[model samples]
Target: MIISSIGLSGYYVNRLVQNSEEIVKDNYRTLLYIEQMQEDLDEIIFNINNKNKTLEALQDYESVLKKQEANITENGEATLTEQLRVGYTKIKAHLEESNADANLIFKDIYSTKKYLNKIFNLNQIAVKDRNERAKKAADDAVLYSSLFALTAILVTLFYIFKIPEYLVKPIKGISKQFQEISERNYNVSLDESRNDEFKEMALSFNKMTKRLQKFEQSNLAQLMIERNRLNAVVEQFDIPILGFSEKNQILFANDRMLEVLQVKKENIIGKNINEIVSNNDLLNLLLNQENSNNERQLLRIIVENKERLFSKRIMTTDTEISNSDSLAHDSIIILDDVTDFIQKDVRKTQFMATLSHELKTPVAAIEMSTDLLTSIKVGKLNDEQKEYVDKINDQTRHIRRMINEVLDLSKIESGIIDFELENTEVNLLIEEALQTVQPFLKNKNIRISTEIQEQLPIVKVDNHKVLWTINNFLTNAIRYTPDKGKIDLSASLKDGEIHIEVTDHGQGIDKENQKRIFEKYVRLNKNEKGGTGLGLAISKEFIEAMDGKIGVHSEIGKGSTFWIKLKTNITS
Candidate 1:
């Protein structure tokens, strides 16, 4: 824009100079015409003063005067033209007078010529001023062009010399250093001696490099610790540990794993899992790579020379296992020795079966005695005998409830019970669970309050399973709460989640026992509680199968709260 303005101003100055020159030329031409007219008038007067001149001389002078007058009229820039006309009029008047009169008029003509000279000088001065202005405008245009050229050169120099060296070079150097680190070259470092931000950045980079090295070392240390823990756990237990790959390679084997496979550790390490074991079915499944995200099945198998049945759990962490072009790093198969757990389970099942069988005899005998005494078959019973029979009946009833609770616990621990899921109102479940424990609340003289959100949506869950979990919470609350204590049941919807909470003013669980409360056969305080210790364990399994979570909050000697969270609108 500045360049264009300078060009435009230069063009305008040139136009003004041209117009002024034309005016000067017109003024000079008009001055010449006035001079000619003045000369003609003088000649005509000269002829009249000589009185002896011929008529032809007078006629020639008159014709010359007429031609000059025509020229003066055509050129209007002549300032002397008006004076020339006045001089001509005076000369004509003096032509009939004496020669002395003509001389005076001629003096007036000279004076007009002097006035015309001043006008011509003024025109020349105006032309000189305009020329000077145009010259200054040209000089300014040259200066503006030089300045713009200089600015452009400086800008280009900045881009070439300053930006590349200071900004681009540093950025590229940092990028190269990162690329080297990504390729696992941890030795690379940014140069920081410039004493600028790059230097500070380099210092930070060195600090981060050291931190990464430390983290890598720490991660290795943790892996060693975890490996040792795993080894220790394997040694302490009789379970076998086996490692396998997709190509049927038996990559690893613990001492027990080798013993169970009836081979040495060295022999088992390089052998195919299928060759070392009796089952090739697991090999087929591992070979058939399908969806990566799906978990592989745990297969139970009987290996050669090992009477105990073993299960193989296959696991892979491939994101594209089903893709033909995808390459898997490894597949791990953990061989767990379920011999002891299975034996213990079998013994437990047998004991419960035997207990059930043995219980019938005693119950039948007591029942028959009571019937006989009530029928009065032998003799009329006294008040004390009747009272004893009643006590026996009450004792039988308590035993029966205890037996039923024990059997339920056994079924739960053995994973035999299946949860029947259906849509049910959580508030109604809480109310039912509360009703079951109302007698306990009354006995303990405790106050119970409930707050259920109105219009609470129904949850897809197993009614019996949810009721059992609620019963567990209330039972724990009742057992731990003191007399006249308070218990609260609350349910609400928050952040698109349904929350059910049970709170009690009881002796809260300690930190140590809180974590273990959900474990099978685990109780928080066994001395103060009487049960088979399966309530929380059963409740947890049931809730999880229905896609829910359970948690507890407790502080010693304060109180405890149990809460359950479940997803809404579950279709399956």
Candidate 2:
């Protein structure tokens, strides 16, 4: 449409330009010739009156007239040119006479002047008429060009509104259907009745939706079956099980867990555990166990009028979602019935306590016998006899120490040990522990370097237990230190706790063994030992029971530092 409008406008503009060129070529040239002829006539009249060059003037006038005669274009211009030429011929003939009559020549001259004026007036009127025609042509060109442009614009606007209905509308509908499919709504299908490429696309889209719908139904049925099977297995278990999401929402609670919690399934599932924990003490304890830094402990609860022990174990599984980069943590809390195992362990502890007690008496009697055998009044032993006596004495002492360790462990396990907590000076505790290990230190010739911070605060702890633990640390330090190696004992107030460290320059423990060194019956060096392997374990229990912490920091070829942290009576 725009091209057609340009072509029409160009045609009208070309016509308008041709009309202007015609006006300039025909009428304007005729007006210029008449103007020159009028000037020549005035020259002929002046020359004739002066009688100086009348013949030349007449010849020039005649030449101009003839040219004007040949160039006639306007209406009535040719006849007027003939009259102008006849008048000019008569003037030339009169001027050619030797005795020229000025009156006749002048008469002819005025007549020719009249003809020239008439011709000039004719050409001027023609110029005005042609100018009006040219203006009318220009108006027609403007009108026609404007009409074509308006028609083109109207056609363009009509298509601008129509093109979207034909193209963009179908595309938008397809896009909407695609969005529905993304959201798992497979029931949507596009229209396939159109006879175009969109028809093919719609046909394929409908087929895909149908397949997806069938797959969704089958997949949903399988998922339901699997879910039912899983629930059945979890319900059959005797152990209490609870599952929670990262947001602390209770995802699932097995039948056993619901029974132990004394609540129905509907009351807890999909609910925030924190909200439920407020009203249920057992649930609160279970949740608290999940956040506790210590190892999971056994919980005692009365069920069906009988007391039972259950060990709480929390397992956290992190799952990565297929559509996300972040990990989802799911926590499963399992409470297994440990009543039978705990009962057996308690009986074993009692038996051990009884055996150690019985052995202590016999061991004490043997020590008394050795003393009697070594008495001066009894006899003067020979060198060989003295050597045997020394061996017996050492063995007996070792046995006594082992028995004492077993008794202490049994007491701690049975929960019968009492802590005599009191405010005791840090310096005095270090001195007392040193005094107990003095003999061993002397035997190894290990130098004891004491560093007590000035104005160190006292600690609130079980005096007997703390002293025992410190003595055990010092003894272990002395035993591990090479002969003539130096040992360090330091006490300082740190972080509202009194930190007492015993360092030994010995063959240090490796990184792997340092983790379980405090566990019961764990010996770092099995070949070089005189301990029951329960000393550090007992010391750990004692320190923990008194609200303190004990750990060792060691590295290969760098010696070991065994330290204990006890709460200070004075806050730092």
RMSD, one per candidate, in order: 26.3, 28.4
Residues 129-226 of candidate 1 have per-residue lDDT tens digits of 66677667667766777688678778888888985576687778888988887765677777767776688889898888777777778878987897
Top candidate on TM-score is 2
Best prediction by lDDT: 2
How far off is residue 267 in model 2, in Å? 9.2
Q: After superposition, how far is residue 555 of candidate 2 from its true place, in Å?
A: 1.7
In candidate 1, which residue pairs clash?
A: none
Model 2 — TM-score against the truth? 0.59
The Cα error of candidate 2 at residue 538, in Å, is 1.4
Badly placed stretches (over 4 Å) of model 2 are: 1-180, 187-211, 228-289, 301-305, 316-331, 380-387
Q: Name the regions of candidate 1 deviating beyond 4 angstroms.
A: 1-299, 305-308, 311-336, 357-397, 413-415, 495-497, 570-572
- What does the lDDT come to for candidate 2? 0.86
Q: What lDDT would each prediction earn against the true structure?
A: 0.68, 0.86
Steric overlap count per candidate: 0, 0
